[model samples]
Target: MWLFLSALVLLAAARSLDWQAWLADKSRQHLCFGAAIALVPLWMLQAGIRDGLEVHFLGLTTLALMLGWRLSQLMALLSLLLVTWFGIEPWHEFGANLLLGGILPISASYFVFLLSYSYLYRHLFVYIFVAGFFNAALTMAVKTLAFAGYVTWSGQYPWQVVVDDYLSILPLLLFPEALLNGMAITLLVVFRPQWVRTFYDRDYLINK
Candidate 1:
């Protein structure tokens, strides 16, 4: 499962990520590097009982909003590697950890962003509230549930313990997660709009 998932990530990156565009821009290079570096500390401060069921504030919703899903995946991979290198996460469980913590939230965030961009009103408040705040909360919920499901399915930890310890605190964490991501996105959209790739001035701010 590990090898297959790792390989699958590689394939997805190869196919989805625009290598030439990302490589040619020095700004993009620096931005991605900085984002990856920033994520390391957030990922380090985690709580877990089982081997691979660690809980951490994933900043991927903000990242996906900033860099778009394709670039966010690459950044998440870099951050995961850094976290593993710091000995916070076990190297043996790399793929499983990446899947649960990295891919799931980033993809979910981007999916929500697309939905808001496509179907909903293209107002700045909508982008900030729906795509940023609400999306962050939902992503947190999905990621928490995914972690609980993984531990239960793999038998790495007891289901009851997961429910009592991990799932129990999920509601408390959601607002903070939303606030964190929503605030970051709001600042970027207001001051450094170019930094957030998913946000467009014309689309969200032109008429209003």
Candidate 2:
């Protein structure tokens, strides 16, 4: 399927990115991360083109802020593309669902992880739990606002349509996404914390 092909292409691209070298150079990684974060809202804008020009600035910005731009960008694109290609809905609906449901919540959770682990608390488990909760809440809130705003502005969709969209999609994606982000952040902290610039280590944990 197209989704599988996209995944293959993404994996290939990632493999070819010279990550070993990129990882060694902080400046290059920072630039790549910045560019990646900048692309998410643009991708969302493209998905929302049929609707009005309302920006769904959920925790994606937070994720970018917390995850050092590069990883956030990479994850956002990966989640968006994956959901679109493999989801049950039609392509258009899939893209919308991805932006609203999968991308937003996961990104929000990533943001929460970044903020809490870096600034507030360094305890890994507590950070993961809080991130999951915030991701779920923000994903729901953004979807509600987006649906209501679309209906108010365009007057084209029925209430049933809105309900159906959420009912059909959001429930399916929430938990798996939270788990993925949680596990990913936890592993990064444990094994490769320096690669994740959003996390700060004072005493050269990598060498020790």
Candidate 3:
């Protein structure tokens, strides 16, 4: 079921991507390739739990906010291939990594940003706080919960054992994830708004 769901989501995301449009623009092409390369190293630094499970920092929220979800998904898939090549992650479990570590965070951040876009005041602080900091934390929180479910379903360890050892410290990851994404987005929006695909000074900063 995990494989099936991951494949389905990847299919949908692949169909949504504008490859031609992205490739045609030189600047975007540089960013697309650069972000994908960056993700490889970022994903490789992991704290392993068992043979197949590991805890790692994810830059997915920052990538999604900067490049938009389509490019972020592509970068994630690219990074997955890179990590598997280096044996940081197993080939057989690529689908799991793609979904849980990649798509999950990107989707969470995108949804929160969409909500902020629709109903919240279009202030810089709102974008940074609600969409950037809080959503990044929430993404990690959800991923941690999903990891718990994954282990339980796979019978990797006793439920009590997984929770007692793993989930106990899972939320500890949230603040660091939030801080990295929050500071990164804050810097991009402040100094390089043009580079962040979703940030618009006119919409968020300039008064109409």
* TM-scores of the candidates in the order shown: 0.95, 0.45, 0.93
Off by over 4 Å in 2: 1-27, 30-66, 69-121, 132-137, 140-148, 202-208
Question: Better model by TM-score, 2 or 3?
Answer: 3
Q: Looking at model 3, report the run of 10 residues with the lowest lDDT sum.
A: 48-57
Candidate 3, TM-score vs. the true structure?
A: 0.93
Q: Which regions in candidate 3 have their CA more than 4 angstroms from the true location?
A: none
Residue 100 deviation, candidate 2, in Å?
A: 7.1
Which pairs of residues have clashing backbones in candidate 1? none
Compared with the true structure, all predictions reach lDDT values of: 0.87, 0.49, 0.83
lDDT of 2 by residue, 100-201 (tens): 444444445555555666675454455445644445445545555565554544566666665554334555445644454455556656776554555556
Better of 1 and 3 by lDDT: 1
Indicate whether candidate 1 or candidate 2 has the larger TM-score: 1
- Cα displacement (angstroms), candidate 3, residue 62, comes to 0.5
- lDDT preference between candidates 1 and 2, better one: 1
> Roughly what TM-score does model 1 have, to 2 decimal places?
0.95
Clash count list over all predictions = 0, 2, 0
Q: Provide the global lDDT of candidate 1 against the true structure.
A: 0.87
Clashing pairs in 3: none
Predicted candidate 1 versus true structure: per-residue lDDT over 1-208, tens digit per residue = 9547856876787698778887899998999889989999998998765556567888889999988877888788899999999999888878877887888888899999999999999999999999999999999999899878988888878899889878988988899999999999999999999888999889999989
Looking at candidate 1, the ten consecutive residues that score lowest on lDDT are 47-56
